[model samples]
Target: EPEVTQTPSHQVTQMGQEVILRCVPISNHLYFYWYRQILGQKVEFLVSFYNNEISEKSEIFDDQFSVERPDGSNFTLKIRSTKLEDSAMYFCASSGLRSTGELFFGEGSRLTVL
Candidate 1:
């Protein structure tokens, strides 16, 4: 099975700096999403993208956050001005199903801000 892959599995950055997390979802999947788990907390949806545009986004995906499908095959999340509270394990998921449907999750990229 083709699974999602994320780069920089773990990153440590300074506060106020910028960080870009990259992901490659299943090639045949139609819907792509980004979610984050704050350590021991539950998984939270950040944003969903489809057909080159944002389909849905949660409050967590604010002005400082952005998503892009720069090359059609890869999806990317960029966090501008990193903060201490931004540390979490970000997951990339994709599915051939609907918004409220099932999804496949990546290994996750852990972000740590100092």
Candidate 2:
């Protein structure tokens, strides 16, 4: 089955540095989303993109953050200024249809900010 894939399963970065987490969403899907889970916290939606534009974004997706679909298969999340609280598991998800509300997620890209 086609699946979402994320790179650099683990990353350690200093606070205030820039980081780009990469993801390749499942082919043939129309909607993509990014979510983050802080240690001991529930998964929080960061943003959702479709048709090359942002569909929705949570408050957590502040000015320092941006997302792009650089190609037909690649979606990327960039953080301009990381913070200690940015340490979390970043998950990339794709869904074939928004009506079903079913999402397939990558294993996750773990980020550690110190």
Candidate 3:
């Protein structure tokens, strides 16, 4: 079975520092996305990427955050200057279509900012 893979499943970082979460989706998927869930809260969409550019981004994806597919197979999210509020379980997802298709998601990369 094909599934998404994420590195550094648990990350502990100091506030104002930088962190990068990496993911590799199923080989055949086209669209990639980053979503996050605060502890005990609903999941929120952060950004969506397609065709090597961001197709949509939420308010959470402000200037301090960035997403990139440096290699065709790896999608990464970098947080510049982390904040305490930035601590969350960040998920990477992929789909065969833009919408209406099932989104396959990696387990998550849990970030803890102190």
Best by lDDT: 3
> Which of 1 and 2 is ahead in TM-score?
2
How many clashes (backbone N, Cα, C below 3 Å) per candidate?
0, 0, 0
How does candidate 1 fare on TM-score?
A: 0.95
Each prediction's TM-score versus the true structure: 0.95, 0.97, 0.96
Off by over 4 Å in 2: none
Q: CA lDDT, every prediction?
A: 0.94, 0.95, 0.96
Task: Report how far off residue 77 is in candidate 1 (Å).
Answer: 0.3
Model 3 segments more than 4 A misplaced: 97-100
Clashes of 3: 0
Question: How many Å off is the CA of 81 in candidate 3?
Answer: 0.5
On TM-score, the stronger of 1 and 3 is 3
lDDT of 2 by residue, 11-83 (tens): 9999999999999999988899999999999999999999999999999999999999998899999999999
lDDT of 3 by residue, 2-53 (tens): 9999988999999999999999989988899999999999999999999999
- lDDT of model number 3: 0.96
